[model samples]
Target: MNRKGYYSIQMQAVCDNTRKIRDLYVGYPGAVHDSRVFRNLPLCNSLEDKCGRYYLLGDSGYPLKTKLLTPFKDSRQLNYNIKLAKSRYVIEHYFGILKQKFRQLFHIKLRNITFIIHFIRAACVLHNAAIDDEFQLNENIDMVNEVLPPEQDLDFVDEEEDRDARRVRDDIVNDLRM
Candidate 1:
């Protein structure tokens, strides 16, 4: 059982606009916060060196970093938030498609965390292969019904915002306004 009082495994993945998984990190207990899990990822450690000019769009649960841009919480930046959400919708859609195709992911009966992790990875690999084959999903499939964890914890507060990250986000907001 996790902090949310349920049995769950934390899986972190990054998918491209093409709906292909680019990076995957799994096996963290559900009790862990997304920000903490991301902070521990090897990808997070080397993101600056690897991404160069690219920036990853993350929800407010993640800390704003040079390579990872998160949405601003204030209502004043609604436009920026909307644009970011639209761009980040791909990952959410990908997860929905994955769960719909692999129904077992909804409720894995496995008890061993290691086995569960491997199982999830195998599913991801198969998902990529399906994408490679250009398999089309059922047109009627409803991706919106997929249950996702809450984006922000009402009780949790983030630390001080990074100056550089805030500047980058503000610049994007300004661009949107222009």
Candidate 2:
């Protein structure tokens, strides 16, 4: 059981600006923090081993890393942060679609974690299939456009320790300012 007093499963997905899921990770319990799920995945290592300038925009719940950009928390940097937040909305939209389309995700009550994982993964697959088939979300559900921030403890990073990551973030911030 999670902190929510019930069994819960979480999914970490990578979505494109087109609001279509590109990749996903599943099977973590609801109590597991998003950053923890990310750290446990091979995805971070794979990206670190790559040579490109690719990066994923994550919300504040995620730790800032060279491969993952997160919004600036300072109120003074609100404008700059909006750029990252706006780009990150695609994943939120994808989640909104997934929850609305597969209502099971909204209120899952399965006792088996394995079943819950498969169920959520299947829903994601079907979601992608529909997108590939040119399906659009119903207007009624489309009205739910806002991203709901998850209730998880934010992971803190030492700016001095993650110097490289900070530099990369600053560079992106500068570029976005142009």
Candidate 3:
């Protein structure tokens, strides 16, 4: 329950990890799965849409691919992360600064899902503004075309976790109805 007995919402953000502005999304309580956010976040969609080779830096939350790079979690098979170390680190370091700026953002305390969405949008918009006066984005941005291991060969073990995650997401949303 929130300060008003309503379940608060959580906002998830995905960025290049070094850029001033991040692609953001607002989700309900208990919706912490990275795949969901990755699938739904408009920012990722927009960025990925732009033509040319674009590499999205992210953490363990989002799915791995040639375009969207993340740190090496395991050494199984030929992982693209082997050559992606430099570019991925940029996002990691930026995330640290983002968290420092918005401490309460990690635990957004709000009821209305719409308001929660707006709160995140507003934060991102401000960050976007800050970037205008700050260093230019993609200044040292790394752009490498490290091919991905065959999709069929790479392992993904989130089905079980996703099932439990969906249950919790449903519960939280249902609880809000009351």
| Every model: Cα RMSD to truth | 4.0, 3.5, 13.5
Model 3 lDDT at residue 147: 36
List, residue by residue over 34-103, the lDDT tens digit for candidate 1.
8888877899778888778888999888878777888776666766777887788788888888898899
lDDT scores for all predictions? Answer: 0.80, 0.74, 0.54
Order the numbered candidates by lDDT, best leading: 1, 2, 3
TM values, all candidates? 0.84, 0.81, 0.52
lDDT measured at residue 104 in model 2 versus the true structure, 0 to 100: 76
Better of 1 and 2 by TM-score: 1
> Per-residue lDDT for 118 in model 2?
88
Order the numbered candidates by TM-score, best leading.
1, 2, 3
Residue by residue across 104-162, what tens digits does model 3's lDDT show? 66767775678777876777776667777674544343454453332221234457644
Residues 1-178, candidate 2: write the lDDT tens digits. 6567777666888887667777789987767888888878878667665526688888877777888887666655666576666676667677777887888787788877788888888998898889899886665323323343434454655576368888988887788779
Residue 121's lDDT in candidate 1? 98
Sliding window of 10 residues with minimal summed lDDT for model 3: 147-156
Better of 1 and 2 by lDDT: 1
